[model samples]
Target: MATRPPSLPTQMKAQFLDAFNTSYALRSVLLPTLTSAHDILIKVDAASYCHTDAVLGAGKMPPNPPSFPHVGCHEFAGTVVSIPPNFSSPSSFKVGDRVGVPGRAFHPCGACFECSSPEGPDADPPGYSVYCPHSKNNGISTDGGFREYAVVDSRQVAPIPEGMSAVDTAVLMCAGVTIYAALKRCGLIPGQRVGIMGCGGGLGHLGVQFAVAMGFKVTGVDNADAPLKLARSVARGATIVDAREQEASEVAVQVGQEDGKKDRGDMGLDAVIILPESQRAFDYGVGLLRNHGKCIVVSFPEQGFHLSSRDLVFRDISVMGSLVGSNKTLREMLEFATKHNVRASVRTLPLSKLNELVVEYHKGEGGKLVIDMALPDEQS
Candidate 1:
């Protein structure tokens, strides 16, 4: 049996963006209602801040941008408040269950080649459906988790593993699954060398930990000393390189040579997951790969990258892009994180600070911030 909310509010407070590049304003709005049998209502507990939210709020998401007066947040966790009488959810989900609504917020057709294939040529790549034309991005196409309550698809919500804090689960919903899918698609084997570009970021840190968990010889490359230190602390025996001090290419070459001398005798890094959006980072990641190695681009960069067709053909280096993790991958990632205790370092703020924090995030002055909606009212 699911626990019902004590009282559903008719109107709730939410952060709304009325125009592009404008500050979000806290406004009282009607609570969202579930219109589908499979839909569920959630009272938000915690929501993590994402750079994507900042970018989308600024109305710079390219040709198609989110509609105005939108609520912006994708990574969030909450408790189930209501389930339709005929709604069918996973057996594990019950009313009052702590749940997480992460990156893949849309429902798939379930009949498309990408959705139906399983580990075959046509199988949807891990986390691939988030980009499907039919998919509706929560924060963009619909109202998202920036408010006291949200209406979400049953398939998009996962039960947070027991004993995990909602704050931790909030960050994991996006960063954890994104990196997990990228590494999975890399097809790395134990003892193979792998490098994480931008290892100190919200997503980079998780990439390092997951690679290390998979028994890959991991190298964390980042420009910031603080993130490097944090990465090193989390991933034991992993190599940390400060990209600011030395060229990423040089670091990769040194590690590759040393790794080749080891008993496994691999020549270069098996793959490099580029976690930053800088063109230079992508270039360095390609440089780090050995012949026939792969590069997974997981970050969003506004600028275009220059790739020499000749260089690509001669080197046999494979470059691919990963958006978000799929439902299957999301489940795997959550189990893996719980089993291996992979957690992100986060700073919690009351939802009241969302506006102020948005400003600070735009200025680039914070680590991973999880908004705790449970805090006392402090709206500005």
Candidate 2:
């Protein structure tokens, strides 16, 4: 077991929003108190921002999100400082263990079909504790990991494996597990071909890496040089396409040509994962699939997809919505990441610079911005 700090703070700084479309503010708030028998208080070490944070902060999360005094960031990693006694926890973690709290941060109702299914303990049923009829998103619906210390449900966190840092694991929390779930839903096997739209962004990049690691021939699609370059670096032997230079339909034609089967318009990708929120990306992704191929819908667009009914019926394309991922898949992805040495290309900034970082993030800056909570005195 790791040693606990000699002292714990009563008050901690947190970045939060007072209302929708408001700026994030850093304020000294009382440290969260424990409530549930399985609740654990953690000293946050790292956290990362996501596009969903922007949507949630705008009061846009569907099915009615709660009013403000909302915290930012859903993906975080920290050290366990306190745990409830007699909890009979599922996780084997104790105080001082490094762990991560991801987006699916609530215990699902065990009575649901998804929970009782034979898919094992990690499968997420339709009525997941968070999202849809249940709106239990961590940062969106509750105070998240923008503070120095946070109170988290024990079931919502998992122990960090050996040879992985908190920041590296933090990248996997939301984006990694999400892509892994998307791939799992598609059911692609080795030698299969997959196209990842927005392959340069956080999720897209990780998607390419995971797909390649799983032995899929990957094609990364994105227009930006920053993401495209990063995608190329991560997805060796994977094809990179520019959306600006060609349409989705055009890319489909090109992919068919790869097999010298341009004469056969029926040839297309085995599966395509849409990672960008752009409808065009979704449309392009649909064009890349072969007959009966799966199109995994993983991105969240403000405006929903405008899919073609004719193509859906005739082309025999199937669409699957992959939310975060089952705990089982998460563990698998983390193990894969650890084995393959896959890591999110990240740019670290002090948590104090969160307000500024949010602005820069909107400017389309490079790399994922991780809030490094190491104080000045704590830094080397």
Candidate 3:
């Protein structure tokens, strides 16, 4: 039933955050082992950096900050080295299967209203076990993918398609799924206009492609030249806007005129998906919506939103928040990504340069950065 590689080592190299506002310490730690019937042990091959890692490192995560000595990174892909002998799931995954874990919903409480459905978790529309408050987050609350080996909840892992690499799958685990789920929450049909507020950043660029693939007319809005260039390259037909060059109202008017709508009632986009962590981005995104349009908030800004009563009541604007996504959504996203050839632009560095990668992320690097665990330490 359960199998592992021959001569598996008892110890492995891992990066750990000793405390908030400190650097990640590289340490030799004991390899993680499967402890539950639903546990799957994976030998991690790649782990992608995320803004949440920076937030956690900087001690900005509110309410319950991650405990000390936590392993960073939530987006990772690897080969399954071991599975519980008594694995109790309708689906079957054996050792040696390539898989990716979405760290958002780990160990969801099956007794909750969101998890206890008559037709089961995989029912159409799926269960909202991702929203179960009692669930443990893989990277945030528990040891995660920064290590050579990780034990993930079997119920939350998805099999990687044959042609996809661990690096690409790692990016899709978080950034891809988050953006895809946010787009779905927009509730717009094909041919409708949608605005991606931070279209050039890690999630925004992917959002642009996914929106275009889904048959929506997209406006890629960002402040930097590089991201604008990236957005243009990815979605050729998208309307790329430089937020630094124009005010939110000005950009809104420009998008309206380009869409051939002169009337104020018909102007503006059907929905604006806010993907940046800037308050300005939030404000600007809200300004780009038409009457009765929706504003889907996916990024967490420290200051939060500053919405006026007019925008909510008079304009009939609906605001909603979306987290990473459920297992069903993850499968759909990966399938859609494969079919559409949607992928994240990523740069890879050896695991030894993880601290440097985090520093680069803080410097506002454009695209995703991944830690290639297989790389030799002397390579970089």
Query: Against the hidden true structure, what lDDT does model 3 obtain?
Result: 0.84
- The sequence of per-residue lDDT tens digits that candidate 3 reaches over residues 1-380 is 44444578888999999988888899998887776677888999999999888888888876578887899888899998888777755677888999998786777777776666524333323343766678888888887899899988877888999899999999999999999989998989999999998898899889999999999989889988777787888875788889888777776777688889887756788999998888888888888888888999998877787887899998899999988887888889998999988988888888888988888877664689999988888775
Residue 95's C-alpha lDDT in candidate 2?
Answer: 81
Give the poorly placed runs of model 2, Cα more than 4 Å off: 1-6, 107-109, 112-135, 260-263, 375-380
| Stretches of candidate 1 exceeding 4 Å from the true structure | 1-6, 89-92, 107-131, 261-267, 363-366, 378-380
Cα lDDT listed for each candidate: 0.76, 0.78, 0.84
User: TM-score for every candidate vs. truth?
Assistant: 0.90, 0.91, 0.94
> Candidate 1 or 3, higher TM-score?
3
Q: Count the backbone clashes (under 3 Å) in each candidate.
A: 4, 0, 0
lDDT-wise, the better of 1 and 3 is 3
Ranking by TM-score: 3, 2, 1
By lDDT rank, best first, the candidates go 3, 2, 1
Find the candidate with the highest TM-score and give its number: 3
Q: Show model 3 residue runs off by greater than 4 Å.
A: 1-6, 117-128
